[model samples]
Target: MSSRFRHAALVGKYQARGIQGPLEEIAQFLVRQGLDVSLERDTALNTGITDYNALTHAEMGRECDIAIVVGGDGTMLGSARQLAQFGLPLVGINQGRLGFITDVPIGHFADALAPMIAGDYEEERRTMLEGGVWRDERLIFDGFGVNDVVVSRGPTSSMIELKVTIGDEFVGNFRADGLIVASPTGSTAYALSAGGPILHPGIAAWVMAPIAPHDLSNRPIVLPDVGRISIEVAQGRDASVNFDMQGMASLLPGDRITVARSSHQVRFLHPLGWSYYATLRRKLHWNTGV
Candidate 1:
């Protein structure tokens, strides 16, 4: 039987060591499956693989039916942010420590992906956050966040002060090492480390977790995604704001970072019988009870 994905685009973490082997293997596997394969520009350049066509992100967006990303969650996050705009469905191959997004094991890629390429897979949609920084009421930087947007203190020992507001209402003035504005997809990331609640992907909410606040009373809060979240740097020597992997440092006072729901959502293809709870159990070691 022929696969629905005739043309596949492969993306990888080119900076990581020992990635060329897997890239070559996957490319060969895809080609053997009777599909035309293209390597992402940088992935091809860095890996020095010239057997297949090298395409830019824009070209892949226009040409390929689906993208197979090989890396950890960080790599998937970066690719998802860039490819989400094109409505491209993605399949992730785990190469990092934690395979939250990259659920497919490197050894089991052929087993899991063979069926998926033939249109026998579960489809999942994940929402993204899109917003920007406002300096003196002027928009400066804007980007998408597949996980979360964070505002934290710089190298100085002093904590940052952030005035939080949800839409028209003022939340509070928090003094902490930093503040995390996370989507449901990010609940298990940095937010979880900061004591934020784990929100299911089906939930349309955001988690606001403060990084080590001065007052213990300030706790992690889950809010609806309907309103825009604004975090203004009230007081801090040097602060920074990060939208997932992209960020701007050395933010001055009065720099407002506004976040809201993005119109585009990432589409992921998982092997048949895949479950969010099952993923949580395996990844979090929930089933390894004593």
Candidate 2:
């Protein structure tokens, strides 16, 4: 049978040692399935693989029908962010420890991917965070957050004070080590570790969790993914804000970081019958006592 995807982009964790063998194998497997394969430019350069065509993010976005990301969730996060603008669908193969989005195992990649290439899979859309730092009503820095946006203190041993506002309404003052603004997709990420509840991907919501607050009353709150949420650095030295993998450090006291749902959503292709609960159980070891 002919593959649904005419071309596939292979993105790998370029920093991983001995990644070339698996990458080459996957590329060959895709080719055998009657699909053309190309390597992401950096992956080809870093891994020293020249067999397939090397394409930039833009080139891949324009040419490839699907992207196969090989690495941990971090690698997937990077690829998703870069390719999200093109509205491309991604498939993740787990080469790292925790495979949240990268659910396909490296050992069983052939078994899991063959059918997916033939358009036999489930597609899930995940939202992202779009945010920026405003200083004196002027936009300073802006970026995208796949997991969560963090506002934290710098090299000082003091907790930063943040003024939280949800769509022009004053929430409260929080004095904490930091603050995390996570999407439903990010609920299982840093926010989960910071005591935030797990939010189902089907829900269109965001979770705001305090990081070691001075007052115990400051707790995690789930907010609807509507309107803009503003967090201002009320008081702190060298406060900073992070948009998932990217961040701006040494922010001023009056800097306000405005976060809202991004217009673009990332599409992830999963194997048939893939369940969120099953992933949570396996990754978090929730089935241990059950």
Candidate 3:
């Protein structure tokens, strides 16, 4: 084990069959290497491992120097919110389709494990968005979003009117499906489907993309991540702000949603040879037509 890291935490998708055997193997390997390891409670129970079991992500976070998530980006996203507070370096062992965030391949994790345990890895700091819905002049919903925050007419097939502004400047009123406020990490998600530009992870930027605008002139835009993005539900029937595709809070007419880059920065550890462009190319199949 590296001097910088003495303990590690294992987190993965709940009830995922492909991960259990690897989880058992990894836990035993870490123990043999003389490094402390904790398993996320549900994962531990699912895998039948008893050592260093943690009931909560917070417990694992406080006790571990590094966290290795063993599933897809969705699992990583869920883990990010809970474990980000502890500021530990996080990595992943991919066990899901299209593992954008979880870049490590389980087939070669054994080869990489020794170097990783020795602190031979690279880390990138990814920014998250602090989003909230303000109703009656106070925060009604608040959370950290690793990807995009969406405001829309929830469960309805009709369009809604939304007034959007960034940093005290008036943008316009958009009558459409909804608006997507995305961090750089989210540029590939819903924002991408809405014609938003792909932003490099190192870029200090965010994107404002309209889901389906009535006016085609209303285009997707990129903005500095430093300021406030305000979205007001001008005309809608029980609209809501969905954070990271996880939870939603209702928004009445005249309710405002604000999003900005959070002060909390989460670090993702990558194996030494990992490349962002390589991941994009492989996942997107950009070379297929050639």
Candidate 4:
């Protein structure tokens, strides 16, 4: 059996326009539950709490039993990248629209925590991707992504050309605006908008989707998680790589980017009543009463 987490850390994007209220409520809720709650410095200031340990992102991941993200999916994505290897479960409280990763609504926060504290909920382990930027055979940037890694043209020129290969098999050369290498957890983000299929979270696969492919026949392809993908920039003045929306190293012509599944996984907490399809309907507004 897995161990239960007793110390909970609260993290939020306090500078994100308006998030102070929810952060305070979550912090108070955790304290009320008798759980040890530590707040990020910015969040603590926003909540008028001063006797708190001001932790950096990495410190929060290392010290916390579980991390509670009280912002949009963007905030959750940033936190996940830092916390993935820490093996701590994360619970996201939605403060933004269409929160695929930030699953819990603000109103349901208390209800969700009830069972989570008692260890009555399930942990969903999600796969992550490790990407390396190689410039002239020298490794430049090594990073990981919980959602998707995007390669796109920078401020300078025209469309980019990318030659992709998967596990020693040449996939195709794509001439397009960009490319998205996504995990099943990220299928609903950029990949979904790029006409990529939605993959179930349990699937151990990655979706390679080309954005605005010049050839209509060159569609998104899903491959085994264990497969290694190499993307070479054939022609482009300025191209760049981003991991889970966080900008990484810039790529020039002839740069090669390799991506594969990372052995590390991230644990996410879901309330016993949480359902993926239900979140889809609520966030997507699938149906409305007449």
- Backbone clashes under 3 angstroms, per model: 0, 0, 0, 0
RMSD per candidate (Å) reads 1.5, 1.4, 1.8, 2.1
Q: Select the stronger candidate by lDDT from 3 and 4.
A: 3
CA lDDT of every candidate: 0.93, 0.94, 0.85, 0.84
- Per-residue C-alpha lDDT of model 4 across residues 1-290, encoded as one tens digit per residue: 24566778888877776577777677788877777788866677765656556676677777788899988898888788888877878989888877988888888899887678767776788999998999899998888899998999877668899999888899788999899999998998899999999888899898999988888998998888887899999998678898887766458878989999998898888888778787778766786773
Give the local distance difference test score of model 4.
0.84
Estimate TM-scores for all models.
Answer: 0.97, 0.98, 0.94, 0.93
**What is the C-alpha lDDT profile of model 3 across 1-290, one tens digit per residue?**
24556888888786787667788787788778778888888887777767566667777777788888888889898888777778988888888898888888877777777788788887799999997888889987888999989997777548899998888999899999899999889999889999999999999998899988999999999888988999999998867788888666567888999998888888898888889998899999987988
Ranking of candidates on lDDT, top first: 2, 1, 3, 4
Question: Which pairs clash in the backbone of model 1?
Answer: none
As a whole number from 0 to 100, the lDDT of residue 67 in candidate 3 is 86
lDDT of 2 by residue, 38-110 (tens): 9999999999999999999999999999999999999999998899999999999999999899999999999
Q: Which 10-residue window in model 1 sums to the lowest lDDT?
A: 1-10
Write the number of the candidate with greater lDDT, choosing between 2 and 3: 2
Error of 1 at 110 (Å): 0.5
The order by descending TM-score is 2, 1, 3, 4
lDDT of 3 at 173: 98
Flag regions of model 3 displaced more than 4 Å.
1-4, 45-48
Candidate 3 backbone overlaps, count: 0
Please provide, for model 1 over 80-147, each residue's C-alpha lDDT reduced to its tens digit, 9 standing for 90 to 100: 99899999999999999988889999999999998989888988899999999999899989999999
Inter-residue clash pairs, candidate 4: none
